[model samples]
Target: MNAKYVKRKSYLNFLQRHKDKPIIKVVSGVRRSGKSTLFLLFKQELIDSGVPENHIISVNFENMAFDELRDPQKLYRYLKKMTTEESMYYIFLDEIQHVQEFERVVDSLFLENNVDLYITGSNAYFLSGEIATLLSGRYVELAMLPLSFQEYVNWHKQNDRYKTDEAFFNDYLKSSFPYALFTDNDQELLEYLQGLYSTVVLNDIITRLSVQDVQVLEKVLATLFSTIGSLVNTNKLTNTLKSAGAAISNKTVEKYIAGILDSLIMYRAERYDIHGRQLLNSQEKYYVVDIGLRQLILRDHREDFGHIVENIVYLELLRRYQKVYVGKTKKYEVDFVAINDQQEITYYQVALTALDEQVLTRELRSLQSIDDQYPKYLLTLDQLNKTANYDGIKKMNVIDWLLQA
Candidate 1:
């Protein structure tokens, strides 16, 4: 069944701004995060803008029809034949990692003056190693993610599925992936998500990394998903796994974690010392790309609402900033430290509720310790005291903050 298209405004705006520029456009994200859908939308935009439909050439390497193009040399020759010097060609290569040594093809096509290249990959290694070195400053990456809270709400409203309670958005009753909106029942949504998760694990991670023990890798992933928004130590994780009868070493645990990260299914936030102005390498916190996926792993502990909400906040910050870190002051810890492309920093503290004087005071301490003139915000779920100002820190509702344009 074909799913209805929801306009991804933020990503569309980014593509619009970078259109026809002298650099390659790379879209990197987790599997089923809508990279292909974004390309379809942008291609239609190009056609509507009178760029000529014949000038656009797109191929999803995952399709069986393009199986032979998995050869880098053949793929390069095919693209060269499709593109001409007389007109501008927008070439989109989806799931580019399916082709072996794809960097050679990308680098070759990049030299064409009349060709504008845009590629999408579900794995981080698509930009690592040779490709990264080959196309260093010649590419601008748009890191795509699943739908934001605002997009989710807007989709529901536009599709006549609107609800006034707003609890569904916070509780995540439906998966946040774009295709989730097409599902009519929870059972169907669960099945779709399960299949998507399996493909990413089996195809993206295990196949790519040549994982010998699938059970061990899954156990490590489960541990990471259950402990979201908390600092993780490899030694302690190894000990915990050993207690559960998994014969794994600390190094193995680290390897599995790195593999999961490279798959783009999860992210790690290192500790940033706010006072010392340096990054601390130990006990970094991890966040899953989608809360719905984390729910599949940690099914029995759904009531752990605090960290779940914090995970949501972390993903939102990632969408906004170039770098998002767990901030550590002299004695306190800020929830997040977001730095944008222009080097502007913002401090945020997230809490389920801060109505109690002691609770509000504790959340405030972290932001107050940062001796900077930058903006500070306290995001909470409290309905009554959603908006307030304590000293210089501005407290606002997380839902409101997420819905911001």
Candidate 2:
């Protein structure tokens, strides 16, 4: 099947906002989360907005065509030839971490008067290490994520004749990466996801870090994936792996977990301070990049639908660029503490089904515990009842809420 065009309106807006800025627009996300595709889309937007095609210089370092330009000096000279002083030049470099000494080339291009730069990479090391120091205060990092449920819905609406139901569509959430939505064949899609996972493990994590103990890293990742939406600690994970005969140390486990975070395969949500209103240091929760990969790794029982709901909620908050955390009050605990630049906070509670009386109370109690007047919401699969308010908190069907945003 031909690749379907799923419009990523949010990312398009981001590009349009930062088009003429001198700072580099750095896009970072997990592997195959549509970073390259979004870059192409932004390029097309620029062309449509009246920029000449020749003024836009694009390069994918992963492509064999640029293999010889691995050295920073050669890359600098190549770009110098393409750019001119007369007009504004837009330069795009995709998967730029594949090139050796890439920071030097980026730094040089940024110094050029006529260039507006954009780059994409799959690893956090691209931001955390020398590149960050080299371009300090001169870049804006746009963290990308897999398709939101709404994006997935719109994508399906474009081609498929059969309209997918909520329960059926929930299966698509099982796979966290957006590219998997392109194909209809289940086996082919699974195989493709598996291959992408392996590539990320090998290329983005192990090879980039020069990690020696692949077994220990794999064990840590498996443990994290299996325990999604639960509080986790390095010491506990280290002990568990030791019991399983992995012989991994706590310090190494911490490092490996950080590596995983850097690769964007998993995200850590720290505990939020309720009274002092700061991020707490202990017992942070981790969520996987894609739910489907989580299912693939833990093939036994799929009984943790509540945790899956939590996972989906986490991704939605991330899609909005909200800083999310576990919120604890005196009497209860909120599932997520979403905060934006305005210091505005929203309390969210997620449950698979709030139909049961006990389930509804348990989810609502957390939001009630917070004495503040911030917006409180309980998101679930309870769609038959569409009451806007429940005990002062907003009651929203998770699917409806996702589609709305």
Can you give the lDDT of residue 331 in candidate 2? 65
lDDT of 1 by residue, 1-405 (tens): 112687899899988888889988999999989999999999988988899888999999999999999999999989888886678999999999899998888888888988989999998988997779988998999999898888888777776775754575654535678888777787787788899899999988898788898998999999999999888999999999999989998888887888899898999999999989889988999988888788877778787788988999998998889999999999999989999999999999999999999998899998998888999999998889788998889999888899898
User: Each model's TM-score?
Assistant: 0.97, 0.95
lDDT of 2 at 360: 79
The residue pairs found clashing in candidate 2 are 174-292, 176-290
How does model 1 fare in lDDT? 0.88
lDDT values for all models: 0.88, 0.83
- Model 1 clash count equals 0
Count clashing residue pairs per candidate.
0, 2
